[model samples]
Target: MHHILFFGDSLTAGYGLKNAKTESLPALVQQKIDADKLPYHVINGGLSGDTSAGGLFRLDYWLNRPIHVFVLELGINDIIRGISPQTTYKNLQAIIDQVKQKYPTVKLALMGMEIPAFVPGSFAAEFRTIFRKLADANQMAFVPFYLAGVAGKPHLNLPDMLHPSAEGYRIIADNVWPVLHGLL
Candidate 1:
């Protein structure tokens, strides 16, 4: 079976959800794989409030597995915490490097995320550019924005408006499925 690893923050982690099996993005993707009868194993490596630095720290554990495809989604918390964009960018690069070294033939899929509108224009613009730059430099498959239509949509979010509801995770799975399927 194909082993696919998903690493990210609360959104990918399905934060606030009582059951990860029913609510998390990896869970939703796994359900799709089963329903479609695809040959794959989906692993969730999300960490709540995890920055790229945290991802860096846990890289060894996840990368040690025989991962065929890796979905990287991080940096939101860093941006929210007002950490330097350059720092976020560097850490992401480090992740890419480590993954490449360990899994030379692995497929990389980047899950992009946008900064909230309330953030200042300059920072938001730069933050948005970070993913694009990384994808370009690493030659990885890019999802543009993970929460495309669901970001500001209240109906799709939980009470905190930060994480997605079950329905919302379906949308994310739908959006990510094609690219992930293509890669595998």
Candidate 2:
């Protein structure tokens, strides 16, 4: 079976959701795929609080199987933790490189995240450019901003303002569906 792996941090992991298995982004995507009778299995490779560095370290474990589509959604935690944008970029690039090496035919999709306005303007801009740069370099599908419509909207996010609520995830799923659908 072909697999579509949603690899990322808490946002992709559905951190604040009460029913992650059914409400997480990946699960929601799977539901759509199933409705359309697509032959694909959705795997959630999200780890809460994980950074780009952490993702790089754990990538091998998730690479053991054949992956048809790889949806990369990391780097937010690194940005939030005040990690250097260069380091995050390098780690993310390495992860993409490794995935390509292991699964040459895998279709790639990058989910971009934005740093809050509180972050330094230069750093935030640099961080924002990384995902698009990577996507362009690799000729992969890209989502300009993963939290475009959901971020900063209290009704769409949990109390902490970081993680998305179930309703928010639904919005995310809607945003991601078109990108993934084209790949499928």
Candidate 3:
């Protein structure tokens, strides 16, 4: 059986939403696995507004599990808070390095986050580059942007416009599932 662990922030947490366990991407991915009769387990390790630094602080707790797949979906909060991109890059690298040291065979997936034009276009270029660089450096699978189709789409987001609605979650699962399935 494959054990997939989702380590992310509000986007993965399904913040300000209901039936999160059933409506979030992690849950949707779980359902897909079940329908396909794939032997797998999905664990939600998301904490709302968690930055890459925060994820590193809690890495030991989640890394304790025998994870076959580890999905890293952080850095958005840090970007929003105007934190340095270098700090974000370092934190992510640390997590990836530690995971590799302990679980050399574990499949690693890095989910990128795009800084919306409205938020500030200056850092978007560098922010987007971080994911690709890390993926290349660590030889891990990479998702271009976690909120690709869901971001900036009013219909797909909740009232807050920050978090995705259930439909949006499906979009996330759609982009993520294929990559994960291939690994499985």
Evaluate residue 57 in candidate 2 and report its C-alpha lDDT on the 0 to 100 scale: 97
lDDT of 3: 0.88
**Top model by TM-score, which number?**
2
The stretch of ten residues in a row with the least summed lDDT in candidate 1 is 116-125
lDDT of 1 by residue, 88-151 (tens): 9999999999999999999999998888767777878899899989999999999999998788
| Per-residue lDDT of model 3, residues 24-137, tens digit only | 988998999999999989999999979989999999998887888888999989988988888999999999998888898999998888776565565777887898899999
Pairs clashing within candidate 1: none
Candidate 2's residue-wise lDDT over 1-184, tens digit each?
A: 7999999999888897999999999999999999999999999999999999999999999999889999999998997799988999899999999999998999999998877668767888898788888999999899989998999999999999888899998999999999999999
Off by over 4 Å in 3: 117-122
Order of all candidates by TM-score, from best down to worst? 2, 1, 3
Clashes of each: 0, 0, 0
**Ranking of candidates on lDDT, top first:** 2, 1, 3
Candidate 1 residue 143 C-alpha distance from true site, Å: 0.8
For candidate 2, what is the TM-score?
A: 0.97
